[model samples]
Target: MSIANQIIKQFPDLLIKKDEPLSKYTYTKTGGQADIFIMPRTVSEAQAVVAFAASEAIALTILGNGSNLIVKDGGIRGIVMHLDLLHTIRREDTCIIAGSGAKLIEVSRFALSESLSGLEFACGIPGSIGGALYMNAGAYGGEISDVLNSATVLTRTGELLHLERDQLAAKYRHSTISEKDLIVLEAEFALTLTERQPIETKMAELTEARESKQPLEYPSCGSVFKRPPGHFAGKLIQDSGLQGKQIGGVQVSLKHAGFMVNVGGGTATDYLHLIEYVQQTVKEKFDVELETEVKIIGEDA
Candidate 1:
């Protein structure tokens, strides 16, 4: 049987898109086609799909909002399972139950409307809840771990488990989840209710700061590199005179040294080249190795 037929025979109702363009799924708007893109409608269905992939030894990957990721020109291999359809939020008294696929923006809006104070920092973060957990995404001194209560995850071996905040071993853009090959299903966050006006004010403040600092007008991942110890990545890059640098259609933003923008017709190769250029320049100028903040995946160019 053909690979397509093989997949269909196993997942009767699974929605599979053949040769789906990776550009449509990434914030960078650049990538080759994925062999098959799958989205399971329910968590159980997702679990079942994952198990089957493991049993069949099919290569698998999970796609979130694409906010913090870059798919290369050669594209992602095997089946890319997106759980964006699983987005749902519920308020259970003092805690919020959110599906892993939920967007941080939507969760922030809901939290603000309900006077939930702890999520204000996430108001402008452009990643899904699951992606946020994986990276421990944060802004304005607050992080996912600050409000996270617990999460349900599925191990690669198909075992389901619950992990609390303390158990997550979350740190700056790193988590125990990163160390393990586990898929997050859902998460619970404990929050305190505050006045609506204050919540609105804080959200607006964060938004304004983002607007002033980021090159949101361009298609780019938020920050290209992480803050190296004792120094800011953006400042170092700027100081190295690498801002406004270009590689094909990709340019290091004039507005922010931290971002690499798809100015007009940027490609994945262009972005990676720019990233490499920045890393090399910074290393040469300051003897500091700048690490990328955006996750680079898929095939090598």
Candidate 2:
């Protein structure tokens, strides 16, 4: 039997598949394939998967929403776990306990439904609760650091842990919580009750800003680089005259220099080559280096 067959046999209840096209799973709509793709419905199911992968020494990676990631055209080896099946949300007195797979926008809407005010910045982030917390994702001058309470995680060895916000080393586009195979299963946030009008206005303003500033009409992994202090990365790239540049099917967005968009049917190689080109051009024109914000994973195409 194949390794994928073995995996399904071992984890009977998991939604398992073989040779699944990764394009269906990613925001970029590009990638080769996944050897083993599994979506576990319950926490116990997720834990069981981790244990099985560890026992077999399989290469395992968990996926939340794929808003800020790029998978290579070469399919990933081993198991690719998805937490979307674990989506659940519960409201506490002044806090929300959210499942990792729950959409960030869903959480924000829930907060609004309760007349809670603190999640306004997350109203437009197109990712799961886990992905947002993983990168300390923020917008409109607010960050996860403001409302994060704690996380329930599963370690590499399949042990369960509860860690506080500071313990995760939450910083810009990173967290130490990911150093191991620690998967975020759940998170809690503290919020406050407020009137409806101001909250609605803030959400509308942010939505408009994102639509106007980002290349939302195309396929992309969102911002390509982390902000380098004192200057905007997009302005620098535009000033270097790299806007609308193309590599294979990838093109620097004329709409937003910060965005490296897949104009149509672009490959991971195209996107990568374009990134390198922009980086090289920016370095030659200015002394500053651009650091990538989106996490690029899987093998080279």
* TM, every model: 0.98, 0.97
Q: Which candidate tops TM-score?
A: 1
lDDT of 2 by residue, 183-205 (tens): 88999998998897888888889
Error of 2 at 193 (Å): 1.4
Alpha-carbon error at 205 in model 2, in Å?
Answer: 1.0
Using lDDT as the measure, which candidate wins?
Answer: 1
In model 2, which regions exceed 4 Å deviation?
none
Clashes of each: 0, 0
Which lDDT tens digits does candidate 1 get at residues 7-89?
88888898888788889988999988788789988998899878877888878888889998899999877788898988999
lDDT of each: 0.89, 0.87
Candidate 2: deviation at residue 74, Å?
0.6
Pairs with backbone N, CA or C atoms under 3 Å apart (clashes), candidate 1: none
